[model samples]
Every structure is written in structure tokens, then in C-alpha cells.
Target chain A: MSTPLLEAQGVRFSYDGRTPVLPGTDFALREGDFVGLIGPNGAGKSTLLHVLSGWLRPSAGKVRLAGRPLRDYTARDLALHIAVVLQREEHTFAFNVLDLVLMGRFAHGAGTLGFESEADRGIALEALAQVGLEGFENRRASELSGGEYQRLAIARALAQQSPILLLDEPTASLDLAHQRHLYSLLDRLNREEGRTILVVSHDINAAAAWCRELALLQCGEVVRRGGPRELLRPEVLEEAYGVPVAVGELEGGQPLVAVRR
Target chain B: MSSPTPDRSQARRTALWWALLAVAWLLVLGLAPLAGAAEISLPRALGFGVPEGEFNPDAQILFHSRLPRVLFALVAGGLLALSGAVYQAILRNDLADPYVLGVSGGAGFGALLVLTLAPAAVVAFLLPAAAFAIAAAAVLLIYGMSRWRGPHTPPATFLLAGITLNLLFGAGILLTQYLSDPYQTFRMIRWLMGGVDVGSYRVVAFVAGVGGAASLVIVWRARHLDLLSLGEQTAHHLGVPVASTRRLALFGASLVAAVVVAYAGPIGFVGLIVPHLLRLVVGPDNRVLLVACLLGGGVFLALCDTLARTVLAPTELPVGVVTAFTGAPFFLWLLFRKV
Candidate 1:
């Protein structure tokens, strides 16, 4: 078997160096895999994402990207590989969507003189088009609706054109239609572009429908890792979410899951 | 993905605006020397043609007094505004100013100490140098105190530490004034009120060189400043050396602001208002914003000084008072406006 694109062996991270948020968890992602990491609130899903993205350092063990230690990569070198869309951001001044999206090209050497090259601008425009924000180039970022802003964030990540994309609750504020739109976009990137995607979400049904693989985490550890059909079983989800859930089938024969309550 | 064609008009528009401002600045510089108590003919004062005979006092006043003063205002104001632009970006606070970081307070205290303690012949250059050293030290101290949160100190914490230091330095200056004799106390008061009476060409050259160098450093790092506006975490993720960039920006901004305060005392509100007003005109692109502020600040303080010294004829108001008088109303208007 080919080596995984990313691997975390016994990775442990703690904010205060005492009770670890990610207590020696082992995880791996093969190239071009669409993986969903889902769990209840405070399950260290975001912490794990941070550790994987180099935002936070693990207290023990190590994470490797492309078979090399993640810590060995410089920030720019790492940025050339992974693009991240954080859960929240607060900007003091308003930037137009074009300007904000163009920032994604920074690591790619787009804004060295604060002027966007033609190629950089082209890439930004294409990324905005991918996010269905082609006409939003002039709109102020701070003035966007919740869903639009989320899409803009995704567009920025897309502009990075990195091989790996990591998202933390990207659809938290998105409506159902917008959420479906975002997943479709991610699906295209994974299948057509052959990019690796890792998403942290609480939406188990959506995760099962979209992600090729699911890792169910509970209390800083993955309780189960398998295909969505295997991990979305009622017994497995109940153990992770601490709630009764039912697994069923749609008329189209696709697996369906919902909370029992 | 298909390649796109970027619109070139925005760049053209920005260049046009800068060119207009440059022309306006030249006009201001030309007329500035003609406005003071002793009126010199605009053409003759500018040394257009040689005078017929005798000692020309108007030429002396133009060369010795008005010219250096005008140049001083331009350089000093430009430095303050440039510093303000950097501070606002690094702190991620629109209200952040050069004085908000305690640079002026520390430099003011340092200059006051020299003025009160040093003998009559302390030389013009040593005072500003002392002030710059102390201001730079104050910045390092604030950064140290605020670094309880690992290598990166968040902007809010840094701002709080700066305010606390500003108050402490203000108290130190007050105590010094209490200990000084009457004549020294009077001199300290005038200096604290801030003066741009840059009588010597040598002082103008020094301010211009130092201020120009600091502005150049900021302009060179304009890209980093743009990233910094997105907050440190986002900037870091975009490959900015967040801690190092923040340190360099803070030092450069503080050094520039201190240079102005060291010589001119602490001119108020030019740093605070110039960038704020320019943002409304040019938007938040720091590359263009910093350049605009650099030129606009020079124009602003030069004009304000002209009005301050000319409006009262023989009695000149403190330049700080002129800035505050004009800036406070505009600030109030901005607060109520949609911007």
C-alpha cells in the first residue's frame, strides 16, 4: 500500500500541559481522501485539526506530512501544501472580497509588493468563481451574510491551490442549500482535482452522505475509523455523541441516519 | 480553471490620486513660508531673483525661520502619520495611534529630563537622541511585560500594556516638573506644548533623513501590514513571520513617532486623524494608504502650523492645539457617519 499523505502517531496536545486535549491520538490520511472527523462538542476535533495544520504543537509524539516530520517544514513550505479555513475571524477594517481572496496567494508569492500580478488576480478570480462568488469581487467582506462569508473563506482556501484542505466547522452557519453546495464543491475538488480534504463537523448525516471516510472521535481519541456506512451505525454514533441515534435507508438505497429523539 | 484578466483601472486611479496629492503638497510648501508674522513677497522670498542691495531681512527670515519650520512640520507630521498607519495595522485597531503606544509619553519624558537637567549648552542633537533611545526602550519594556502569553502577545494585551506605560511615563514627567526650578519648569511646559520652531537647517535635515528612512521601512513591509490586518493567526497561516514582523513594526513605528516627539514635543491628533480620514478616501489597502498618509500628513501639519502661527500674528498657538481644534470635530463627524 502507498504511504499515507499525513500521519499522526500518538500525537498529544494540551493547552496547559496538564490534561491533554488530544491525548495521544493516532490518525492518518491517504492522498486524495475525503475524510470527516465528527464528534460532540468539546471532543477535541478542532484541537486535532489545529495540531494537524501546524497551528498548535503536540506535547508528545509527532505528526508527519508526506513522510517527513511536520515540524521540519517551514511555514511557507507547509502553506504550499495545506490550506486552512478557520471557524471564526474578526477583521478590524473591511476588505473587499477580491482583496481578501487574493491574500490566499500570499504564500504563492502573489502579493510581494502589495500589488497583485495578472496571474495572481486570475487565480483569485477563478477561486471566487469556484465558490460561486464571481460577482462578489467588489463587496466588502465584513458586509457579507453568514453563508456568503463562509463561501468567501472557502474561496480563499481554494485560491491557495494547496494539495490539502482543512476546514473546521465550515458549514456551522450555512443553511441547508448552502451546506449542500459547499459539500458538492468539496466533492469536486477531491474527485476531479485529486486533492485531500479533512473536515471537522458535528453534522453526522451530512458527513456520512459526503465524506468517503469518517473518524468518530470521543474524549480526545478516535473511537472508530471506517467507511461512513460502517461508522454511521446507531451503536457507533451513540457511543460518540452520547445520544440515541437510528440508522436507516432511503428509498434510493443510500444509508440514512438521524437522532432517535 | 481559466485564467482571468485583472482590471487595470484601479491601479491607474490610485496613481492619479497620489499625483494630485503631490501637486497639492508642492503648492502648500511654496505658500507655507509666505504666511508667518513677517510677510515676504511670495516670489522674492522663494529666492526667485537676486535683491538689488542692502541686508534683506525678509530673505533671512525666509531662509532661517520660515523655511526650516515648514520643512520640519512636513517631516514630523509625515512620520507621525506613517507611524500611526503601522500601529493601527499591527494592533488591528482602527483607533490605535502612535501616542496610544506610549512612545510620545516616553520620549516627552526623556526630552523633558534633558531640558531640565542638562546645562545651557547641551547641543540640539543630543536631546532628540536621548528621547529616541528612551522611547525605543519603553517599547521593548512593554513588549516584555505583555509577553506572559508565550512568544506572541495578542494585540489587545499589547495595547493595554502600552496605555499603562503611557500613564506611568506621564507621572514621571509630572514629578520631574515638580522638582525643577521656575525657569526650567517654564521651558518644560513650552516643550511639552510642542514646538516646530526648527530654526536650523541641520535639524531639518536630521528629521527628514530619520523620518524618511522610517517611512521607507514601513512602505517596504506594506505587504506584511496588509496580512497583519487579518489578525496574527491569519497572517501566520498566510506565511507571515507574525512575532518577528510585529516586533519590527512596533520598533519602527515607535522610533519614528519618538523622533517627532523628541524634537517637536508631542503634536496631538495628526497621527490619530490623518490615517483615519485617509482610509475613508482610499480604503484599507495599506500599500496605498501608507503612501497617502505620508504625503497627506505632511500637507496637514504644514497647513495647520501656518494657520496656528499666522492667525495670531505675533503670538503663535501651539501646533498641538491647532490639530486638536481641527481634528476633534472631524472625529465627531466620523463617529456619526456611516463609515
Candidate 2:
């Protein structure tokens, strides 16, 4: 219907000129959509995310964001439009949670290298609050637990205030409760805030329960793409994951998937 | 979560750090010239008023010797520290310094080359220019080597490349020393030890001019340095032009290191120690950290030079020796403390 917020057509990527990871891949995201990218290990899910966010260039074809070629946007302009929550970074520097979060405001600020204005500070604080890390602003990032750090990372992207958010394996280190919290937060941002979100997760049940659509990546290709109901069927998942996964349902008819013995 | 609130406390704390460091720096500036061999009143040395009973020779000593030496220490220390901080940030390692990137080694080689080739009368001009050129070249070589794996020079590769370059330059200097005559060898040895024994104001002016320009460039890019600490990809996502920023930072920092090494003969530890110490006091914000390093580094090196001149009372150990003696202990303690 409307122009897709982002689209990749026949995109191919390789590492060190080896075999292509995303060989002949095609994907699209609509505005305000919650999409989950679920794949088995080494299926190039993270690589695809990097390609979409312009962190990595595809060897063939191109990615278009907001009807513009991804390469057409400078890093600054692209950052202003797309916020990325990377996997848990190492505690290399002694930046506090607030400092890390405020970094998200880098692209949105006015001058060449703008200082954090009062308004920027307010937005950063609000973002921290949104992630329930308000009082933890003064805490060192090194001091944060894995789940708290993930939340802080999310807070940083929230502070970016971009229209689109891309997260890679956000729930990998998170506990059950934090995972639920993160999923709900992503859902709320997608629905209430009208932010388009593409989250990569290995948790199929969680992906089915939360995301409006799921894209199953098998090896390097988007093998199946549809709503949870259509993609969570046993035959499709079995083909993609190469595991006999039992696809069942919750009390509310949400899909539940478990690996068959 | 509580209502959104500005971090007034952090802001106030940073302000307090600035005020305190500024005041302490001014005090060091006043007292630095007084700690040398001859006694000179702080007021008289600062040119506030001539003391009624002050001797002309002591005043002459203050003006001719101590004053220039102190000024040189302040400027050179500030430059070295700023260079160290920049290297540490761009290279993302605590051990990254001018010496690590072979700047000091290349500079040392340049100085020895001047001694071996240029006449004594024209050495003052030739030495610094040659050193600066060679040091910059060495850094460029290091950067080139680090970029072997595509565009992104990973921190580990960068550090290893620097170490390799340092060894290569170090061998060159050693060869130069071996080839020189006894008198030239003596001069090279003294220069390599790194000292702050300024005999004239001209050297002071040269260092201060270059150091001031370099510090300004660094402060202007301090915000980028802050973003860079997040690592390249994250910083890129945050809109920093990582490649250009890396290039500019390397050029600016290497220029400061080369010029200071040219003038001061590769004074040790001020660059490495000042930033490490100040980061603990002022958090990791580069805006504050860089400025604080400028002042704190100046004071630290000035104080160390004072001790170098006075501790042995006319024996005059090289300022580098004093710095290593002091810095080595702190560095070891820091390592053991695991901070």
C-alpha cells in the first residue's frame, strides 16, 4: 500500500569475500510495524540487521530507507532516522548510564558537535525513565547487570528518538521477566509511539507472541515471511530450523513453539 | 520511574572540579618558579612588585633560568598530556601514548640526525622541524599498518602496529647513536633523557605556540572524543565520522607529541600519568577531561621538574628520570589496584 519504510531487494553480503551471507535476499518493513527476525544460529540474522542499518554495505543490490537509498544518507542523517540498540557492548570506558544514554542525542543535536542542550538533557532523562533507569543514571555502565545493561542500551536508542529502532539479540542475555518487559516495551513503542521496530531474536514463542509479523531466515535467505499464524506452522518452521518443532497455542490463541524430542 | 529531571548534581560536580583544578593550577604557576636552585619570591617572580631586599642575581636567575624553565614545563607537559589523552581515546587503550606510537623514537632519531648533519649554530631550527616531520611520518606509517584489514583499524591491530613502529624507530635511533662521534653521542644521550632545562625564552615561545594551537584543536574536538570512547561502530551510529575523526585526531596528537619532543627531548610519563589521574577525578567526559589534563598535566610535570632539579641539589637528574620514578610507582599501583 504505502511506501515501505525500508526495503531490501536482492541484497547480498559477504565477509572477507567468502560465501555470501545474504544471498539474493529481499525484505521490506512498513511504517509502525513490529517485525521479528527469527533464525537458527549462523543464519545471518545479525548481518542482515547490520546491512539494513547501513553499518555494512551489501555486495550486491542495495537497501532503501524511507524511500531513499541507504547509501544516499550520511551517517548523521541515517542515525537521526534509525536508532540501533546493539548487543551488549564491553565495558571499555567508564561512561555512566546517563552519559551513554545522552550519546544517543548525538545525531539530533544542532551544531557540528553540539553540547547537550537543556532540551536534549530532558529527552535523555525521559528516555532513561522510559527504560526504568532514571535513578540509575549515575551508575557506571560496568556496574549494570546484563539485563540492566540491555535496558540501558535500549534507553540509549530511545534517547536517539529515531522513527525506526533495530535491535539485535536484545533478549539473549535477559532473564524471562526482562525479556517480557523488553518485548512489551518494543510493542508499546511500535503501536503507541508509531515507531517501526525490527528485532532479531532466537525466542520463537516470544517472537510469535509479540511481533505483528515474523520473518524466518534459514541460512542466508528469507525462507518465509508472514503473520505469526502463517509462519509458525510446523512444516514451515521445520523446514527453516531443520528441527521438528511442535507448534501449539496459548490460552489466548497466541502461538507456542517447542522443539520436539 | 521518577519524573524526568536534569542531572544538576553532575553538572555542579563538574563545575566544582573545574574551579578546583583552575585554582590549583594558578597556585602551581605561582610556586613552580620558586622551587629551583636559587630562591625567588613568588610576588617578584610574577612581576607583581620588586621586593625591597631581593638580590639582582637571584632575580636574574628567576627571569633567565627558572621562569623560562617553568613556562616550558607547563606548555610541554600540557601538550604531552593532551597528546596522550587523544591517543588513548582514539586508540582506545590506557597504554597508548606518544612514545607507544614511536613519535618519541622518531623524534629522537630526528634530533640525532640534526646533531650529526646540521652545524651547531643552525641546530635550534633544524632539530624541531626535522623531529616534527619524522614523528608525523612515523604516526602515518602506524596508521597505515593498522588499516591493513580494510578501513576500520581495530584497536588491537593499531596498538600492535604502533609497538612495531616504535621498535623500528628505536633501532634507527640506536644506529644513529652508534654512528655518531663521542661528542655527538654525548649530546644525543642528554637529549634522549628528556629534560626541562630551558636556557632561553625562544624555546619556551616555540613550544607554547605549537602546544597552544594543538590544545585548541583538541578541545574543539573533545565532543567527538567523547563519542569515540563508545567504540567506532557505536560512535558511527551516533553520527561521528570515525575515519575522519581518527585521521584528524592522529594528526593533531602526533603534531603535539612531535613538537614537544623536538623541544623538550621526549619528556616521559606526563602524558601517560596526567590523563589517568585526572580521569578518576573528573569522570570520563572529554570536555572536562581534556581541559583538566591540560592544567593538571602542566602542574604535574612542573612539580616533577622542580624535584628533578632540587632533589639531588645541583646534580640535576633528567626530568624524564624523575617522571619515571614517580610515574612507575603510580602506574604499578594502578595496575595492582585493577582500576
Candidate 3:
């Protein structure tokens, strides 16, 4: 069997010692896997993502990426391999889109005292184009709409050209049309480019449409891990969310999730 | 990514405008010495050779005293503005200025301590340098104390620490003042008022050396500074050594301010206002903003000094007073505009 592209073994974490946010969670991702992490609020989905991306250290266990311990890699080294799109985008200072995207190339060769090279700019432009923001490069990031800003964040990650992309609710604030568009883009990225994509979303429909694999977490522990078909059952959804959920098939042959009234 | 070709035509236009502005400012700075109470003629002011008779008294005064004062003002003003720009970029705080991190207060306390306790041994150059070094240390200490739980220090915590340190240093300054002699008190008052009358070339060269070196260091790190505005965590994710880069940038800014304060005695508001003014004109890219602040600050201070000298004629007002007067109104305008 091929080695897992990313693995978390017996991971545990807590902001305060009393209630653990993540308790001995073991997870793994193979290459080109489109995984969706679904859980209610405070279920440790974002925490798990932070651990997997090497942004946060697991208290009890270890994370390994590409067969190497995650802690051994510097933040920049990890950035060149894994890109994370955080939930909120904020900057105290305003930056134009082109300049913001170009920051992703900072690790490749741009030193602290160095300027962006031609190659770096090319990657940034290509990333922008991939996200349908080719003409908006000069626009200030602060001026972007919610959907446009989400695309910009994705573009920044794309500019990193990393194999693994971790997005935290990439479509959370986006409209329905933009949501479909973003998932389709993620789908293409995973299928054609063979990128390892992991996304955390509250929308079960979004997970069902794009993710081949699904993991359900509750109270900081993974309760279920399987294909979407197995985890998308009404009972599992009800248990995970503590709300009665009706899972039905749509006319178009897609799974639909609705909270029972 | 391919190299982004900045519009050559636009760049050319910008270059032309910058060149024109620079030349005009230089001419104004040069002619400022000639406009004082004595009114030195243009030919005599520009003359390389002293004429066959006694040196033109007006030209002599202009070249000897007023010219150096104006140069000092220009250098100090430029350094303070550039330092403020660098600090703002590094801290990612729009309100950050060269003195925001308690550097000015720390430097003031240091100089006051030396003046009160060891009056005769207080060397002119050492006063600001000592203050600057202590201020840098204070900043580092505050940062170390405030690192609560995360790799990144929150902006609010940093600001609070700076304010606390400023108050602490202010108290120290009062203590030193109480211990000062009548003679030392008078001198301290004059120094606190900030004068540009550095009567020697060596002082000018020293200020120039410190300010020039610090400015170059800041400009070289301009790209990194731009990335830093996104916050320390993001900058780190993008490969910047956030802690080290921040420390170096802060130190550089403090050094520049320290040198200026050493010569000009804590000239206020140039650091705060020049960066704000340049931001209005050129947008917030540090690479462009920094350069603009440097040139713009020199010109602004030079003009302020000229007004200070010529406004009251024969009896000059302190340039610091002028800067404070101008800076206060501009700051108020900025607050209203931003709101």
C-alpha cells in the first residue's frame, strides 16, 4: 500500500486543561483524496485542520507529512507543501490583490530582503487566472466582496503551488452560485491535478457533492470515518449535530440533508 | 509567475514627477538659508570662492549658522518620517509612530538622568544613543512579557505595553528633573525645547551617518516589511522570520530616531505627520511610501524651519514648536477624514 500523504496519530489538544478540544484523534489522508470534515460548532474540526497543516502542535501525539515528522519542518517548509485558507481574512494594512497573492511565493526563493522575481509574478498571475480573478489583480483586497475575497484566498494558496490544500469553510459566506462554483473548482483540482484537498464545511450537501471520503467528529473525537455514502445516513447526521436530520435523495440523484421541522 | 511589467509609460511619468519635486525641494532647502533675517544674495550664497574683500557678512551668517541649522532640521525630519513609516509597516498599526514604542520617553529619561547626575560628562552624541539603546531594550522586554500563549503577539497588547512604558519613563523623567541643579535645569529646558544649532560639521556627519545607515537598512527590507503588514503569523507562513525581522526593524527605527533626537532634541510631529501625508499621496506600499516619506519629510521640515526663522525674524522660534503646531492640525484633519 502507498504511504499516507498525511497522518495524525493519537493527537490530543486543549486550550485549557479542563475540557479537551481534541482527544487522541487518529487520522490519515492519502494522495488525491477529496476529504470533507463535518462536525457541529466546537467539534474540533478547525483544530484538527490546524494540526494536520502543522500550524498547531498536537499535545499527546504527532503529525507526519510525506513520511516526515511535521515538527521537523519549518513553517515555510510546510507552507511549500501544504496551503491553508483560514476562515477569516483580515489585514491591518491594505494590499492589492497581485501583491497579496505574490506573498505565497515568499517561501520558494524570495528572501526577507529580496524582491519578487519574474517567475514569482508569473505564478501569482496564473493563480489569479485560475481563480477567475485575472483582471482584479490591481484591486485592493479590502474592496473585494465576500465571494471575491474567498477566491482571492484560494488564489493565494494556489500560488503556493502546494500539493495539499486545506480550506476552512471556503464557501461559508459565499452565495449558492459561488458555492457551487468553488466546489466544482475544488473537484477539478483534486481529480485532474491529483491534489490532496481537505475542506471543513457545515453544509452536508457540499460535502456529499465533492468529497469522496468523510469524517464526522463530535466533542473533539472522530466518531465516524468512511465514504460519504456511509457517513451521510440520517441517524449519523442526527447524532453528530444533535438535531433530527432527514437525508433524502434528490431527483438529480444527489443526497440532500434537511433538519426535520 | 511571470514578471509583472509595471507600465513603463506610467513609471516614466512617475519618475519625472519625482525628479521635478526633488529638484524643487532641494532648491528650496538651499535657498532657505538665504532667506533668514540677514537676506544673503543668491550669487553670494552660491559662490564657491570668497570674494576679494571681507566675506559678505550676510553670506557668512547664512553659510556658517543658518545653513547648518537647516541641514540638521532636514536630516532629523527625514529620519523621523522614514522611521515612522517603517514602524507603522512593521507593527501593522496605522497609528504607530517613531515614538509610539516608548523610544522617545526612554531616550528622554536616559538623557535627563545623565544631565541630572553626571552633568559635565554628558556628551552630546551619547545622550540620544543611550536613550535609543535603552528604549530598544524596553521594547524587547515588553514584547517578551506579553507573549502569553501563542507564537504571535496581539497588537493591542503591544500598544498597551508601549503606553505603560511611556508612563513609567515619564515618571523617571520627573524624578531626574527634581534632582537637577538650577544651571542643569536651564540647560535641560533648552534641550527639551529642541534646538538645531549644532555648530560643527562633525555633528552633522554623525547624524548623517546614523540616519543614512538606518534608512538604507529599512529600504532594503521594504519588501519583507510589506509582507509583515498582514500580521506576524501570516508573514511567518509566507517564510518571514517574523520575530527577528520585527526586532531588527524596530531597532533600526529607534536608532534613526535616537540619532535625530541627539542632534535636534526630540523634535516632535515630523515622524507622525510626514508618513501620514505621504500615505495620502502615494497609497500604503512601504516600498514607495518609505521613499516618499524620506523626501517629503526633508522638504516639509525644511519649510517649517524656514518659517520658524523668518516668521519672527531675528528672534527665531523653535522648529519643534512649528512641527507641533502643524502636526496637531494635520493629525486632527486625518482623524476626521478617516472617520
Candidate 2 Cα misplacement greater than 4 A, ranges: A110-115, B1-11, B40-56
In model 1, where do residues sit more than 4 Å from their true spots?
Answer: B1-5, B46-53, B123-125
Q: Model 3 residue A248 lDDT? A: 85
CAPRI-style grade of the A/B interface in model 2:
acceptable
Please state what fraction of the native interface contacts candidate 1 reproduces. Answer: 0.46
- In candidate 1, which residue pairs get closer than 3 Å at backbone N, Cα or C atoms, i.e. clash? none
Which TM-score values does chain B get in all models?
A: 0.94, 0.91, 0.88
TM-score of chain A of 3: 0.96
After TM-score superposition, the amount by which residue B161's alpha carbon in candidate 2 deviates from its true location, in angstroms, is 0.5
Better candidate by TM-score, 1 or 2: 1
* Per-residue accuracy of model 1 over B39-141 as CA lDDT, tens digit each: 6875675566756775667788888889889988987888888899899999988788988778878888888888877777874667887787778778888
Candidate 3 stretches with Cα past 4 Å from truth are A16-19, A110-123, A251-253, B1-25, B42-63, B121-126, B147-150, B178-186
Residue range A1-261, candidate 3, lDDT tens digits? 799999999999887766789989988889999999999999999999988987677778989999999988876798888888888756766677887998888778653443566677788989988878888877878888888988888898898889999999999888888788788888999999999999999987888877888899898888898887767899998877889988888776678888988
Q: Considering summed lDDT, which 10 consecutive residues are worst modelled in model 2 chain A?
A: A109-118
User: What does the lDDT read for residue A94 in candidate 2?
Assistant: 92
Predictions in order: lDDT: 0.85, 0.84, 0.80
Task: Please write out the lDDT profile of model 3 over residues B255-285, one tens digit for every residue.
Answer: 7887777667777888888888877776676
Per-residue CA lDDT of model 2 for A1-261, tens digit only, reads 999998888999988788888897998889988999998898999989989998888989979998889989988898899988888565556988877888888887632343476787778888888877778877888988888998988888998889999999888888888789889988988889999999999888888899999999987888888899888999887888788989889898899999999
